[model samples]
Target: MTHTILGANGTIATELIPVLKKHNVNIRLVSRTPQHVEGTESITADALDSEQLLSAILGSDVVYLTIGLVYNAKIWEEQWPVIMRNVINACKTTGAKLVFFDNIYMYGKVDGIITEETPYNYISKKGKVRAELAKMLLKEMASGNIEATIARAADFFGPRATEKSIPSVLVFEKLKAGSTAQWLINPNVPRSLNYTPDIAEALYILATNEKAFGQVWHLPTPAPLTGKEFVKLAAKHLKSSDKISVLPKWLLKIIGLLNPFMKEAYEMNYQNEFPLHLSSAKFEKAFAFKPTSYEDAVKETALWHLNR
Candidate 1:
């Protein structure tokens, strides 16, 4: 079996490559600026281009959509549908299965723990876009156009996570520099987040399992932690000051008025305003895998940041 990983350089894909390699399948890593690696074939292509994507995915058994778009709402609104359509069409044409690494944006604000059965109550513009794209994929799956599975996860942090991710920018970097850490919304609200390797492993497990098709699975994550706890844990591991401050939603909104990324993030601040934890019982029942504990995850992440 050949697995083509789109956005091969992404945080999740970086971790996923080794997992897929352990399965001994041929790997093709694709991205706009791809690099040749020892164990995989590398290709350069714009995933938004149907022909380019088809060329990269042909003769592959699975296509993993680990692509990360720029952190701009307007860009996501314009690009997500087009990218999904191209990938779906290519998968249909080539008989490759799709494993999409999705987020919980479509669920908006949920009442209790989020399960696979969570309804789409689109709140923000980005959430609506996510809901629509997910619906499009599900419709295609229902029609038997493609074999696909959606792996939904909360905000993630792991090895090689960029500054764009909340944990990396606010927690890891600040710890590395011995600077005071800052977080969005209330730092005391317990929120769920998956370690990157866990998410990657789950994606591979779901892609390999036939029963996982045409469904959405929340990847397994250990117990939830508040923003303060998350940072304090890392501080303990790094022996740095645990001093942290919360960034008010109003301040983020004011900053977003001029900054595109902050502007888009302001709309999603609802996630931090309240606790939103994802439940993974369905995934554990299917795969019997547990995610890494927060202590171990934070240690590894802190080490990675120190080295980076």
Candidate 2:
């Protein structure tokens, strides 16, 4: 079987490549500037360009869309739909199954635990873009135009995800550097975070299992932990101080005024203010998979940052 990754070299895709290699499948990496991995074919292609995307996906048995665009609402609104449409069309034309790596932004401000059945009620521009892309994919699946599955994850942290993960930046990296760790909004609310390696393994399982198609699956995640708890755990592992500074919403708003990334992040601050719990019971039960605990995850993440 030939497995193609549309956005290679990102944190998730980087971790996923080795898992696919273990299964002895032909691996094809595609991106605008893809890095060459020994024993795998690497092709450079822009996902926003339909012709390029289709050519890169040709002859693949399965395709995984793991692309993450720049953190800007305007960019997301303009490019996300186009990328999703191009990938869906490419998969349709190639007769290849698709596995979409997705986030939980579409389930904005959930009053309770987030599940696959949770309704879409996005509150941010980025979330709206995600909702539309999800709807687009579901529409194609409903019409039987393609075989696909959506693997959604909460904010993730693990090796190679420091650039994209909030906790990796605020907690692990800060602690590693002997600096004050930070948490956004409230430190009391519980938040669910998936380990990157676990996500990679679950994606591989979803891609290989025929029965996993035509559905949305939440990748296995451990029980939620409060921001304070997360920071303390990471600090303990890193042998650093556990002191944490909470970045209030007002402060974030002020920072957003000057920092474009913070400005984009401001709208999603509700996630930190509320209990961000995600339930992967369906996936865990179906695959008999267990997620790595926060204690171990924090230790490994801290070590990675420290050794680097």
- State TM-scores per candidate: 0.97, 0.98
lDDT of 1 at 142: 96
Model 1 spans with C-alpha error above 4 angstroms: none
Clashing pairs in 1: none
Predicted candidate 1 versus true structure: per-residue lDDT over 94-143, tens digit per residue: 99999998998999999898899989997998899899999999999999
Tens-digit lDDT track of model 2 for 1-308: 99999889799999999999999999999999999999899999999999999999999999999999999999999999999999999999999999999999998899998999999999998899999999999999999999999999988999888779999899888888889999999999999999999999999999999889999999989999999999999999899999999999999999999999999999999999999999999999999998999899888888888889
Go through the candidates in order and give the C-alpha RMSD of each one to the true structure.
1.2, 0.8
Candidate 2, which segments miss by more than 4 Å at Cα?
none
Write down the lDDT that model 2 would get: 0.94
On TM-score, the leading prediction is 2
Q: Model 1, 151: alpha-carbon shift in Å?
A: 0.6
